[model samples]
Target: MNMQRSMLAVLLASTIAMPAISAEQGGINAEQGITTAIPMPVANNAEADAQLSAEELAKQQAAEQAQKQLEAIIGASGLEGLGEQARNLAQQVLNETQAPLGFQYDVVDRLTPLWAPVALQNTLASALASLDDQQRELLQSTLNSRRLQNARSKELSAIADQDNRNYQDYISRLRQQPPAPARVALIKQLDEAMQFSALLSVTRSSVYPQLQAVLRNWQPPQDWQAGLQRDVTEFLLYVHRTTPNDELQRLAQAYREPVLQQWLAGVKKSLSRQAG
Candidate 1:
C-alpha cells in the first residue's frame, strides 16, 4: 500500500510538470512568431518616418511663411501701426460678440467726462509733430478715443504740485515732533487718506526714521515684556509691510538688540506654529 501511495504522488508531480513543460515550449514558439512578425512593422515604420518628415517640413514652411509675413508687415506698416491694427481688429471682434448689454457704451461714456484738453493737445503734438499726414492720422485715430482723452484729463486734475509740496511739508513737521499720541493720531489720519502713494512717500521720507529712533530709545516698563514683545512684533510687521524686503533687513539689523532679537524669535516661532 505504501508503494502504491508513493507512485500516486509521483503521478501527481508528473501531471503538474507536464503542463509546465508544454507551456514553456508554447511560450518559446510564441516568442519566435513575434520575432518573425516584427519585420512586417518595418514597412509601417518607414511609412511613419516619411509621414513625420513631411509633417515637419510642412510645419517648417508654415513657420517660415508666418515669419516672412511678420517681417513684411513690420517693414511696410511699422510696429505701432501693427499694434493699432491688432487693437482695432480685437475691438471689432469684441463688438460682434453678444456677451452683455450696454457694457462698451457705458465704459466709453464714463471716460468722456474726464478728458483733459490741454494734456490731449500736448500728447497729440508730441506724437504727430514729426510724422507725415498718414502717420499723424493714424496716431490721431489711436489717441482720438474719448476714453483716452478722459484719462489724460483725470490724471492732470488729480495732482496739484503746490498742494502736494505743502502736504509733504506738513507731514515732515509732524514727524520731527516727539512721538506723542498726537503724532500717532496724525499718522493714522494720513494713512486713511485715499492718496496712498503720496502718504507712503511722506511716511518713508519722514515717519519711518522717527519711529526707528523711538524704538531704539524705548525702555520697556517692568512687567511690560509681553506688551513690548507684542509692540515690537507689530512694529516689525508694519515695517515689513511698508518697506521693501532689503530695507526691512537693514532696519532689523539696526534694531537687533537682545530684547528685540528675543521678541523677533518669539514672533517667528508663533508664526511657524500658526502656519503648521
Candidate 2:
C-alpha cells in the first residue's frame, strides 16, 4: 500500500512537469503532424527606450531655450562687459534708482484723477506753491488725517493687501505642483487679477496732491494770498504725460520669473473674485 501511494505521488508530479517540459522541448501534434513550441510574449524594450530618449531630449531643449532667453536678457540690459566689479556696481545702482521710479509711476498712474479741470488745476497748483514750509506740513498732515478718517481709504487698503497676499500664496503653491493643462487656465485668471491689484495699489497711495506740490516746486510767493494754480497744473500734467513707459518695460523684463508670473496671476485672480 505504501509503495502504491508513493507511485501515485510520482505520477502526479510527472503529470504537472509534462506540460512544462513539452513547452521547453517542443512537441508534435499527432493529428496535424506538426511540431511547435509554446509561444511567449516578447517585451518591446525599444518603445520604452524611445520614450525615455524623447523625454530627455525635451528636457535638453527646454534647458537650452531658457539659457538663450537669459543670455538675450543680459545682452539687452547692457551688462555684457566682462568687468565683474563694474557690472555689480551698475546692477546695484539700477536696483536702487529704478525701484522708486517704478513705484512712483505705478502710484501716479493709479491714483491721479483723470482730466483735472483747467481752472481747478491752476487753483491746486497755486495753493500748493503759496504755502510756507510749516503751513505745507500742517496742510499735508490734515489731508492725511482726513483720508485716514474716510472709509474709502481703509476699504481700498484692506482690499489691496488681501489681493497681494492671495497672489503670493498662489505662486508659492504652484511652484511645487507638476505642470498641467488646468494650470494654464488658472494662470490666465491670476494674471488679470494681479494687474487689477497693481492699479488699485497705485490708486490707494494718495500721492496726487504731494506729486502736484513737488511738480510746482512750491514756494511762499511775495503775495501770500495769491494762487499759481495754472503753472502747477501744467507741470503735473507734463510729468504725467512724459513719464516714460520704457523704464517700466525694462523693470518688467528684469523681474520676469515663473514665481513672479504666478504671483501676478494670483493677485489678478483675487481681485477678480472680489469684483465678481
Candidate 3:
C-alpha cells in the first residue's frame, strides 16, 4: 500500500489512544508489545543505552512515564474482575476489527522515523496517565457502563471496521461525503480529548531529522503529513459512526478532563525534545 493509504493503520487497533494497560495492572500488558514490536527495536542497543545524554535520558523517562499512563488508562477501563470480564474487551474488539484497515505496518516501518510512533504512543499514554485515580476510574466505568447500556447496538464498535476496506477507493468518496457539522464538532472534541494534533505535530517534527540521521538518502513526500492527518480524522469518524451521540459526547468529554489536558501538555513538552 502507498503511504497515504496506510496512514490510517498507524492507529494500530487503537483509535481511542492505543492505551495499553500498565504494569500496575499486571506484567502481561500491551506496553510490552509497543517496545518489543516496534519496527526498529531501540531496546536492542545495549551499548548505546549507557551513553545517552541527559536530554536523551529525560526524553526516555518521559516516554516511559507516558507509556505507563497509557497502560493505566487501558487497564482501568476494563471491567473490574479477575475473570475474562476484566480482560480488556475494548482491546479485543479492536484487535478483531483492525484487519479491515489494511494494517500497513510495512509502510509505517519504511517511511516514518523509527522513534516517531514510539514517541507518539508514549505521548498519548502520558496524556492519559495524567488523570487522577478517581478520574481514571470514572473514565473506565463510564466506558464499560455506556457500552453495556447499549449492548443492544449490534457490534457497535465493529460497524466502522466493516466500512474501512478499499482504502484508496474509499478515500475520495469519504472526503466528498463530509460528516455533518455536528459530527465534525464532536470529532474536533474527540481530537482535543486525545491530543491528536499536538502529538501528531510532535512526531512530524522529529521525522525528518531522525530520518536524516539514519537514512541519508531518504526524503519524505510533501503530502505525507496532510494525508496522515486526513486519515486520522476519517478513521476516528468511522469508529464512532455507530455510537449514540450522547454516549459519544460523554466519551469524548471524559478525556477532556482538566487532568488529561494538563498531562497532555506535559508530555508534549517532553516529547518535543529529541531522543538522541
lDDT per residue as tens, model 2, 124-230: 22323334445444433433343222422433343344336653454355445533544343332332322322433322222223343333442323442122222
Give the per-residue Cα lDDT of candidate 3 at 57.
Answer: 62
Per-residue lDDT of model 1, residues 9-33, tens digit only: 2212221110110111111122457
At residue 52, candidate 2 shows an lDDT of 65
Native-vs-model 2 lDDT? 0.32
The candidate that wins on TM-score is: 3
In order of TM-score, best first, we have: 3, 2, 1
* Residue 10's lDDT in candidate 1: 24
Supply the global lDDT for candidate 3.
Answer: 0.49
Quote each prediction's TM-score: 0.17, 0.19, 0.46
Q: Quote the lDDT for 271 in model 2.
A: 30
Error of 1 at 106 (Å): 39
RMSD of 1: 33.9
- Give the candidates in order of lDDT, highest first: 3, 2, 1
